[model samples]
Target: MKRFIALIFALSLFPLSAHACGADTDCALGDRTYRIQMPDTAGDKPAALIFAHGYKGSARGTMRNKSLAALAERLGVALVAPDAIMDDWSIPNAPGQSTSPDVDEIAYFDALKEALISKHNIDPDRIVVAGFSAGGMMVWNLLCARPDDYAGFIPIAGTFWAPEPTSCDTPAANIIHIHGTSDTIVPLTGRPIAETHQGDVNKTVAMYIANGGYSASDSPDMTPDLSCESWRSEQEATMTKCLHDGGHSFKADHIKAAWKTLMSGN
Candidate 1:
């Protein structure tokens, strides 16, 4: 989805199965709706990628990226993208506007994951979650709420507003944060969301590092187009931040880079 004014936003290969979905499907979670795609192989217990689209974007809008489809093929994981009720996520309360649904989004997400696991026999340990922009903020909230629920997290061009949680419910998972140095919408330096303030990208990373109990060490790995850095604590957790030259947009290369980095171990 293109970055339009207000809003913005997996891994693993399990075995091949005989009952995979060849195309996308319109799935429902009580009153909410989402789009899901299964691999051609009928691999039960396959890995899953749950994607949250940018604000005001639909599941179909997110799937239009093409890279996500390519990602499913590349990683052999089922792809699922859920739509937000108000075309905005329920992060911080926007002035004169409600970003998310009146319902419990956390519970919605939980049900979504459980539905996939039960229907497809997905591997709970291999489920990875990712979001962009507002969706990315959702990922941050998810991390704070259920850090142990996923194997990996990728928040692209995302941030959290003031009143964000200072700690997570459990140990953090492997995380890779990708952002653009030139983004003004959700700038790396941070911006105000309604009456609250979002932290800078660097500060956001530092917060995640602190939660994971990892200390910053070694200089950032640099390249012509990107600056990549990581904070690690032995085998406990690893967090990587990548800043590129693009604006607030999700490039195909970004998805590819995230998949490569997060799926490197499995």
Candidate 2:
């Protein structure tokens, strides 16, 4: 974690990376590296979106695709895409597991935000954290574990892995989730494990709604389509589910819709 913090500090000093960094250099947070994508207009103090990639993926891979970058650009938001330690999502098998290589990912985010705040004109209250697949699981962990730090969350094809309802720390942030009903990697029905209990998309949504002080009857009305699917909450905090036609991989249209939802809140 210290190493990753040092890298992020270094990148903040010199914002530059070879590919995804564009003009900004890749920042290190322990053994991880991240890429930043800024909005076209300068001095706008735009809302920042921090992105976590899927299992075995890098920030560059997540941001390299034009469609994802287009969403950030269209929304006029800045993106911070970070690489996971060991090129994989952290899901230790043991209970009370110490983080691999002692990389405290939660703290890494704090440091990244500090650097971003110092270097960019960011709206602190509008910060959003987003992720895909295993990274989506990480997103939920952050929401439950570090609820006070962020305004909202976006998790794609991910599940909650808490052992019990009480284990799910109350989320002070709103959330939007995108999942495929047929996702094999992280099944829509969720998987059973020893250390923690994994939850389906619906369960996760319900949990978030309850945590956000919304009743079960307040669940959003769904608008399903061939290209996109949406569920909007009846409360101040909104939860949307984008049902992908296929499985596993992310759909650009759903991501675009998610971006639209985030921008709408702003």
Per-model TM values vs. the true structure: 0.82, 0.75
Q: How does each model score on lDDT? A: 0.73, 0.67
lDDT by residue (49-168, candidate 1, tens digit) is: 888888788787877778887878677888888878776777654433645456577888898889888876888888878899888888877777877788888888987765455666
Q: Candidate 2 at 162: error in angstroms?
A: 5.6
TM-score of 2: 0.75
Worst 10 residues of 2 by lDDT: 217-226
Lowest lDDT 10-residue stretch of candidate 1: 9-18
Instruction: Note the clash tally of each candidate.
Output: 9, 12
- Please list the Cα RMSD from the true structure of every candidate, rounded to 1 decimal place: 10.5, 7.3
Judge candidate 1 at residue 173 and give its lDDT: 70
Best-fitting candidate, measured by lDDT? 1
Show pairs that collide, candidate 1.
8-54, 9-54, 9-132, 17-41, 17-42, 17-43, 18-42, 19-42, 56-87
Index of the highest-TM-score prediction: 1
